[model samples]
Target: MTTPDKPGLRERKKQRTRTAISDAAIDLFLDRGFAHVSVAEIAHAAEVSKRTLFAYFPTKEDLVVHRMADHEQEAARVVRARPAHTTPLTALRDYFLDGLRRRDPITGLNDHPAVRSLTELIYGTPALIDRMQRFKAGGERALAEALCDTTEASDLTARLAAVQIIGVQWALSADNFQRLVQGETADGRYEGAVRDAEHAFDLLANGLAALT
Candidate 1:
């Protein structure tokens, strides 16, 4: 008998493996905290060999926190892709507002205990925090390049604008995460934070016009 063709089989297999590993890592980290978890345990729980797990997630931390890298890259992409008339601050404001409306986990809408625990784990871990800072720096560099592409500003001006925009976002995200961990509902904080973010962006856009 001829073997049946498996359409989209490779993609599905890769996704399944990735999901299994991520779920297993999250479960273990929530149960025992991040520092105590090992790659072998994550591999075992996911029913994959250590080598297979490494193929999906190069590090134990990657299995638990892969989505963050995608988010930072996407933020820079959105700014770069904004319409010619739209300023970078405007693009970032819209992106963050959309995130708030969707109650995205990155905006701290998560209510699960495990999610909160993982946030605490990330904050408490120095290595993970350092990695996150590096990720943010890379994202800022990408954004600065994009800004430079769209404007005639000097390299220093573009870099400074990118730093200010990213720093504001980082602060806002931390505020929302803290609110979530403190048992505040998303709706309770959404309106106030949105207003604050708008004002913050307005200042960036107009107050910094002379510099730009």
Candidate 2:
């Protein structure tokens, strides 16, 4: 598996370019707000042409919310690749816990100043919020399909499980992000956040296992 820590040369180059663009976009958005910054300005700041920027990011909302895209369909991927003896929810729980340990930004436990700024930018902007919700809806659908494929669950059962699991996770992450954006540090909240995550998954797994 081509994990991020061991990216190929071409992947590394692409990552550098992507990082440059995202860093420039984030600086502009944090300084001027997501709604106030234009795609052209971001492209210029990143030293990329507007067409090239569009090539990487289809829309202005994407420039700001692309960070969310990094793990948009991760649940589905995790469910599909789980060990044979592991339940989907168990795999997801372990995956989330690992992310929390790494302070991964996707887990809402990362303490980077830029992450907090980006969180503020997304929630405060109506367009960005809409885009993010769409991304999450897509994740739910993908996970539902994966659940059905892996467990031979009926469509309705799979969707119900997906909604319950994803909803709890999204809520927990939102709460964590809100706290961080409102002047809390990750270290101060890490223990409580992990506890909350475990509880959320426990609730979700109970409900998931009971699904007919």
Candidate 3:
């Protein structure tokens, strides 16, 4: 058996730089809202040159939303990796339920101060909101492509299904975030969150057929 190689020194250094830049940007954004913070300020805080910052993140919005980059392909990966005989909807539904259990920020069930603050910032700023919508669309497209690969469905059918699934997940996450922001504890809201997820997935699994 071959051991997987670790990231080389160059890769590790680049990752450290990226993390520093991202951390600096988030700190500035949280302290002075997303709209008020400048990319130059973040670059200064991270001790990186403006050119280096631009090379790492093309747009100012990317500085803040880059944390979501890991999750961009998550749905598609789940679809591609599900166990044999498991339907895509079941795989995704179970994945989300597990995320809620772990209080994953993507599920919007995390009430940590940092997570809540970032969520509020993104929801409050128009520019960040627009950027987030683009992220969501990319996620949907990836899931659609995965669906087309794993099933015999037409491209249109796969895309429509992806849209509905991704939309439902977003709506659920938003509702969960709103509850937390309203001062509800994540643990206190756990039961209700689970119920809502189940109900939403159930609708996706069964109710949509009635529309045909």
Winning model by lDDT: 3
lDDT of 1 by residue, 1-212 (tens): 97865868878988888998898888888778788888888888999999998888877767656857687666669867888787667777899888888877776655566666777878877767877887789878988888788777689998888898888888887888888777787788888778877887787877557533
* TM-scores, each model vs. reference: 0.88, 0.87, 0.94
Ranking by lDDT: 3, 2, 1
Q: How accurate is candidate 1 locally (lDDT)?
A: 0.79
- Model 2 has an lDDT value of 0.84
Clashes of 3: 0
For candidate 3, the TM-score is 0.94
Instruction: Write model 2 residue lDDT over 1-212, tens digit each, in one string.
Output: 86555558778888788889988998988888877888889989999999888888888888767776758899999999999888889999999888878888877777787677677778788998899889889999999999989886899999988888888878888888877877788888889889999999888867677532
lDDT of 2 at 191: 91
Q: How many residue pairs clash (N, CA or C atoms closer than 3 angstroms) in each of the candidate models, in the order given?
A: 0, 0, 0
Residue 139 CA displacement from its true place in model 3, Å: 0.7
Alpha-carbon shift of residue 17 in model 1 (angstroms): 0.2
Model 2 misses residue 126 by how many Å? 1.1
Q: Candidate 2, which ten residues in sequence have the lowest lDDT sum?
A: 1-10
- C-alpha local distance difference test of each model: 0.79, 0.84, 0.90
Segments of candidate 3 deviating more than 4 angstroms: 1-7, 207-212
